[model samples]
Target: MTTTQRDHPSIIQADGEYLAAIATGRFYPGVLLFRSPDLTRWEQLPHPLEQVEMPESGIVLDPDLSYVDGVYHLLYGTALSASESGFADSPICHVRAPSPHGPWSPPVLLHAKGFHPSLYHESGRSYLLWSEWDHRPGRDSFGGTWAQEFYRGTRRLTGRAHLVRGGARGARLHRRAGWYYLVAGGIAVARSPHLTGPFHPDPHGALVAEGGPGCLVEGRAGEWWLTAWPEGGCALGSETVVRAVDWAGDGWPRVGDARPATGAAAPVPPGGARVPAEPGSTARADGRLPAEPELTAPADERPPAEPEPLTHTDDFDATELAFCWQSVRRPPDPGWLSLGERPGWLRLRADESPASRHRVSLLARHQHQDCEFTVLLDAQPTHFQQLAGLIHYTDHTRWHWLHLTHHEQLGRCLAVLTSDNGQLAAPADPLPWPNGPVWLRALLQHGELRFTASADGGSWTGIGPPLPVSRGFLGVCATDLTGARLVCDVDRMSLRPLSSPR
Candidate 1:
């Protein structure tokens, strides 16, 4: 996977176009959706689940999308408790809609057996597939892939769950040329003549032996393609990549070179040729797909141009926040966040402490590469309980904060705080600031972090010593440690990349 901070990508062809859904992990609105015409150049669609009320510290994981009989089914797991060993009490849920851009139905509970749930449909029947988590001592946590019958009309699962394939996780079932192929974690492939029978490992070995997990899809010309995320040193996290799949004479699929390539041929031709729909397809008339841009190159001839580094500026001029901004653990509640309250500024009411996982007034976007983030903050705290500033956040236990707070001796001041795995420390003494809106900036480059502040927008002054860090979310936050609801106004914010990672 390689672009724009996405994970566990699952793509399927629907209505002559390709659709993708990915896990949101610790963020609200469970899954993110995207559409493509040529298997490249994706446009983000409206999220399926808009408002999800999860348990405290619950996270959405491994979302999978599939289309059948005019309805698009989305399957995902919500992990209520997790540790380094494995997840506990993770429940798989299901939702369906007429289209990916949807007013989706409420999530229906499927089972709590495991995570990474996927739906497989055949002969007008649907089956739920997932990796079974084993907690026995001295045994692998990933027991195997299990399958059970799912009744769409009744909206419930029936029959006893049974193991289909063992020794691998994230197993996806596909049929090509009269053979059932089980691609597990993109690391191994097994074949079975029957859908629920003994599966044998491929004699030619796995299709992709290296890199991250992948999903296989057929192209417009009936050729095979692999949508995968190859592991590497990337600041933006894993990115989605497409590779060509070769079929052996013995009916096995193969990715010629196991390594991720920088470029590959386009799956469809210049005019965005549509794939032929399956036989007896009953797609609804209202399910119109998005328009695809016309390209100039022929199929398998030229690759699409690589996307440039991300740069964005938010003046809080719009009525609602853009899709790029995401809050931690919960959706941005209007009760604590507002754009119309102030004409041109964003008003954020302080929530719980920064260390609290339940609720925190923080809004951030993914940091894709070496970049600089600047914000104009206007906040005045009567005591040391309130803080508002820029943060480079990985999670609750790890982050770097450059905040403005009140000090007993120094009055209103600025300070730098660091948290490594929940161990908190103040790296620099507080610096007194004059009463007014201040421009705070954070520069992240080559795994090091530095902070600077400016009275005006031009001249900058360093505040804290350089500290080692890693790539994560960059955003502004306001918190009141004493539980008093204080307000922080952000006039403007911007981000620009210092260097691009190709």
Candidate 2:
């Protein structure tokens, strides 16, 4: 079944807005950001670091944002994959801006060691926290939690780094009742009466809340709450959960029943702000909820915005590209990925030489594992290695793609190619290319994938047997990507669930 798509949920309350950031790895220009007036209905804001680039090859994972002293500070982890050898460490970087929206400063290196970095501030003191990986032969388990004094304005670390705890991620800190509560992979505590310390785990040393890794936030009502991303919600991706927290007699925050909150609760703000009256419904027309609103209006009269659909269809009818389209690393180069150049069609200029994931002229949307992605491609490739089609891309190392290209010997054909690690699979039987508009579709259900094509948008025909699907996601990445150019016009694209009627 389909599920609400969110993961690595990092959220904080700032500037009277609850800003939530989720990890969108390898989908360059990743990290989806959402802001809610109340806490329930989150609307996606323009990705803050959509244009930020890292050196060489790496993925940006688990970004954290905190607004301090009239500036919004963003920090994220960038490193080569663990599978890659040599200097295996992910370094965290920091960027700041006057506002969460727009004109962020360039990324500056911070700490090095592991991924999933977070920022915590207490009483005018800033701290940068991250996982520490020790890869000296026998340190197999994940490294412990480490912290260092951070200067947001200067984007530099100060003083000596300290090992706060062991073997954890998403390490979070909050102070209450003179206890510095620490929740990393599991619940822990440090009663040092100070923000930074010689912290210690709970006396009981047992997991208080067992569902998933999450952070703690106090509500307007002086009650503490916990938010986590529990697994096994859906086939698509991870889901967000919020729960109430209580303090125990032993001085530890008693995170009540590990079960994720599936119901409404008051938000974490002053004056008792609460979830929206309707699920996924914006509290105000302009996304600004009055401190107090007259609730005399009927539920049916409220804006009937439906829950976000898993499927979307774009016909290239608008002058501007849809917000779903994002480039791999930085902003999409207008020279390669353009809309106005082709009137009603989206023209993607496919270069002959394959470039890095960051430089390809591909615009793609995040796709679930069990969904159908259908696109109408109108292309006329006349040279070898000149191809254009749909890509099931996880990253540069792992992917499966089906494209239409031409060769002097093979003429026009359809090829399905798959790659894992760095080994490439030879393309499958080259199917005879059909004339006119080529409609290509990728049917990914559970763990099975099938590629189909049609002369028209309807009346489809299978190109080959169903191939085993990878846990990877669907995106567009092409090769034969530089030097000479091949233009492919995408007429239309649509995504739908497998069980749903077409």
Candidate 3:
């Protein structure tokens, strides 16, 4: 699937020559048509359909494109009529062209009335299978009522393709041994002698795999496999892995070869991972992803440009988030983030807390393994105490946050990791860096958190003992502790993964 789109995942780098989807800026969904070679390098073909203001209906999923007979066919999820999730919610929308490179047809809202749609053509006629959702509130985020709502409540959209009405997501199928066997997310399988499934569910593949509710399909290599993301897993917001799917003596779909897709012919180093592909787009590595200099943003921050988020540029540049900051608000604020108004400064305005799980307010990307990053913040809030620094957090209430701020008693910028059931956890020791202004450094060396401070970028002072944390995204925050107004001014920041590139 495409990565980096604003709402639905954007298709950034594609198969060397096609750049299907892209982001115009950090805002609005920008779709690009790209071409690539060897999945490492990419080149953007002209734009097919670029929507300036993508409607925010949460009902409409991002549109996906694929080449069929040298022509392009775009499948997107859009709102037919609003409900718990429309027939078009996760269902498929259509846009086609006679040729791969051409003027795309207007998006056709092709769907039956009540199911969450997934587009695929087993035989000749394209099919849209989906589960209709009952989006009324408090209906259990997972389990129970929600399941019942999804089951009984979900009806296939009663439209043209009535036979393909049995879609409820998480389904996959492939060609092998003269069979087009299918598997849905609930771990259920339906077998069809042919593609147009007048299929029957095998008792076995009714439910398997873990994590959360997500759609899956055979891998690029067509091996028995699947990958899942948490329910409402904000499109490509999380790193999803591919796992192998197995089969029983009776052709029942089972989990097998569950390793992720590398987009490359080779595999990633141990513990490293990649986001598997979906029906649309292929993966490419050495392509046009921002020249991530130990984690920095590309100068062209708009569409047609890529950001160096975590690609290892080795320098933070103040404009980048130092790979150690994660957002921690329940209804996390999207506006609470920005980079490069001043080129080398990371700024944080105030934002609302997240509402529940997966809804983090501040921005948190990844930090490398056994690394060191310097974080420097220069700010004094008028209303609330503006806090900014790196973190290794899990959730709003879980994990640890190591940052700099103005402590009430100390009356100076202090370095601390606040983690207590109640009240902010005090610094492991008093502020180590000079009160006024200085460079704060935290090193993740062999699982130990060693902190050092420098008044000038050259000199240094030890903060204290290293803090300990699990392998996770290094977080950063710009919270307004007192008023609804916390802001931070930063001089500079940088991250260096001690190990050399492989």
User: In TM-score terms, which candidate is top?
Assistant: 1
Backbone clash tally (model 2): 8
> How do the residues 315-422 of candidate 1 rate in per-residue lDDT, one tens digit apiece?
998998877777877777788899999979989999876677788898887776678899998999768888989988887888889988999999999988888899
Cα-based lDDT for every prediction = 0.75, 0.64, 0.43
Segments in model 2 whose C-alpha atoms lie over 4 Å from true places: 1-4, 81-86, 135-143, 165-167, 186-192, 203-213, 219-225, 231-240, 248-307, 352-358, 407-410, 426-428, 498-502
Question: Could you give candidate 3's per-residue lDDT for residues 1-502 as a string of tens digits?
Answer: 2222122222222222333332221112224444433222334444444322333323334444443323445555544344544223434455555433445555555543333334443222233444444454666322110011000012122222233323234343334555555555444556555454455665433444454322343334544444444233432234333344654444454554333222333212232111122222221233112111122212322243332233333333653443223343121223555566545566666433221232233555445555777766665533324556655544344345555666566655556654533345555665733455556676776666676767676987776565664444453555664556566545555566775321
lDDT of 2 by residue, 1-502 (tens): 0134565566777656567776667665656776665566666666677667644456777778776666677887776656335355677888776655656667888867776687876545577777776666656545777776665445666666767633255677666655565676444444444444555665545444344456666654576666654434334435456666766545555555542333344223223211112333323454332232111311222232233566788888798766567666556667677778878888887742223544565667766657898888877767657778887766666667788877677788887777667567755787778656688899988688888888877788787677765545554544454357777888888888666421
TM-score of candidate 3 versus the correct structure, residues matched by position: 0.52
TM for candidate 2 is 0.79
* Native-referenced Cα lDDT, model 1: 0.75
Residue 102 alpha-carbon offset, candidate 2, angstroms = 2.6
Q: Which pairs of residues have clashing backbones in candidate 1?
A: 1-229, 1-230, 1-239, 1-240, 2-239, 2-240, 3-239
Which candidate number would show the highest lDDT if scored against the true structure?
A: 1
Cα RMSD, each candidate:
8.2, 9.9, 12.9
Give the candidate order by descending TM-score: 1, 2, 3
